[model samples]
Target: MIAVLIILVSCCCFIFSTWYTMYKNRNLPPGPTPLPLIGNLLNIERGALVNSLMTLWKQFGPVYTLYFGSKPVIVICGYEAFKEALVDQNDAFGARGETPALDPFAKSRRIIFTNGERWKLMRTFTFKTLKDFGFGKKSFEGKIQEETRCVMEELRRSQGQPMNPARCFSYAFVNVLCSVIFGERFEYSDKRFSKLIGIVDDIFHTMCSIWGQEKNDPSSPFTSENLLYVLHSLFMGASDTVSTTLRHALLIFLKYPDAEDKVREEIDRVIGRDRLPRMDDRLNMPYTQAVMHEVQRFSDIAPLNGPHMVTKDVQFRGYFIPKGTNIYPLLCTVHRDPTQFATPYKFNPNHFLDEKGQFKRNDAWMPFSAGKRMCPGEYMARMEFFIALTTILQNFTLSSEKEFTEDEVAPKLAGFLNFPIQYELSFIPR
Candidate 1:
């Protein structure tokens, strides 16, 4: 009787382990083999999630899965997979992945990182508020114009000397958001605003630190974490990405002086030498618009839109994705997929221009992402980049301060965001 009881328990344990293993591996997308308990966590870098995933896509097919400590993460690569997941089944993938660290910080409020009804409410409110402020309005153009004037003044004060445009551009960009959300502009030297920016900067720096960990110890304000996450996403999304793209734009122009001359010719013919290019003239400037699109495509910032989680069990293409599976949309794979973009690796403005020489929209061009969880600040970002780039280009001829080549200005991966290594440039007044 004792031997029979022991045998029965041993059999039951073996069966349970086998069932669990099968359940975890069954009907999932193809990916790197995960260990029995560790999953793919060991394969991934501590902080460089995007780079690691992109490398995986090169090995695995476009659509693959990864595991984060037994948690399944679906990585959608190439344009087709990204479109299908983000657009076709938008509602199914609307939920954001909950992280132990982010939960305490977010409290699940704010538009950038919330889900469900809260996401809907925050998005709608933000959209309406932005529309009321200046999006799609005549006054909106005026606000951008005002900000451009300030940027131009600062550039002019540089006296055609080499200077870091990052600070000036960031201040102007943040002020644009401030004008709409906070309803005021901050002085460049304001202590409080400066501190806020510093805090935001720290959050970004911390996010990229692999050794950093979030502590939920007592005596910490909830608002501090909340503000940190919000400002981190904002600064990371807005400042580093756009500034890097603009830096690349300058490098591209210098490398191809003919294109630069053509852009200047277009601006000269459309707006003339005395006045700066205005938002209203965007329609008439096909080359400039094409250049902007190419810059976005070539830079391919934010290759993956962070991680998203499955809220319910889902089955697709003969695969069963259980509840709580995480999904990562690989925007870089989509943007650079040979199947989608012609000569995907080449920097070509014609990709965004039609035979008629007018601006054309490409469905495959999804720098801001797509679907229910697409970038809420898409319109605002476009406006900022357009106003900032065209405004600066219209007034100045940009080139490297030293004899820096395009290869020298190429971006080195900095966490998820790719930025041009520290390089200086001269913005000689046109």
Candidate 2:
């Protein structure tokens, strides 16, 4: 009789445990069935997270929930849902989710991850500092012109020889940021600056590894396990992503020479062949603006911007999302959403141009994201990319070694940021 009682009690405990889990998750958003304790561990395939999340969006609608070791992750794929959470409820969704790896690095300092009062203070300071350095003014235009001259001199030194433009582009981009932040610039030959740039690249590649996946020998200089992570993030976040986009832009231009010709023609007509294009010319040069927008859209960098954390418990469409819930903003999904774009797959600049050929603003074209935490250096980055791209095209013509096609330039997912496989091209002087 005692043995029978023990077995019955054990069965009751098991039933209760199962019921408790169901009760806890009863009001959570819909998702694939999660196993007890392990949650959805078995459902997640390795190294295909972005693809898997996209598939989940199709199955679970715009908003869905997934569990990672008992932690709830809220995935927002649809633009409307994302807008509702990130924009409408901006204050609630402003906090970045905790990553064990990034925690040590961004313990407090950097603007990207730090939240609350710290984030507000840093963000405000960064914007003011950027403006002081000519981010949206004529002073900034002079700096870009100077940088363009430096690039022209460097390219001229190539003497029409086949040389990779990555290094030069990286230097110009980084220098622009350095001038704005550190109040200085570095020569291309400066070894310390080169090392700093290398460290930045390393951090970017390391962060690209999926969360929880560890690399780097803890002792290595490139290892971004601590304070270095913040530095690495700032540099890599600003430099590599922009540089890779520019590289892809050049490659795409060579592949689509007709588009290239049109852009150059527009530049010539607006700014003329005598002087390099300026930031002011961005408005007057509609074709060039369209091409710039198209490059950003087609590149699709930072598919998933790490993860966001809810600062306070909130209700969304009758679902209660507790504070500290991880939120994944599917940027790629929004950029390619058919509901928002006409031809989500094609590389047409017409997406940004209206019937009259004027640059048209699309709410969906959010490469740098929207709301409070949008990229702080967006204005500076945009001006740099435009000035560098148009100036290069204005001075020279680009072509590949062989009949390289756009389809051939497949994007290799570099962690979160997508980059094209290395390819060669020639910059012929026009």
Candidate that would win on TM-score: 2
Off by over 4 Å in 1: 1-24, 45-51, 99-109, 209-241, 404-407
TM-score (C-alpha) between model 2 and the true structure: 0.86
TM-score of 1: 0.84
lDDT of 2 by residue, 179-290 (tens): 6557788898999889888876665556561212243544322223433433344566557767888897887877788999999898888888899788888888888888
lDDT of each residue in 168-256, candidate 1, tens digit only: 77667766666655678777678887776676556654554211223353422223454444434665555555666777777777667
Among all candidates shown, the one with the greatest lDDT: 2
Query: TM-scores for all candidates?
Result: 0.84, 0.86
The CA-based lDDT of model 2 is what?
0.75
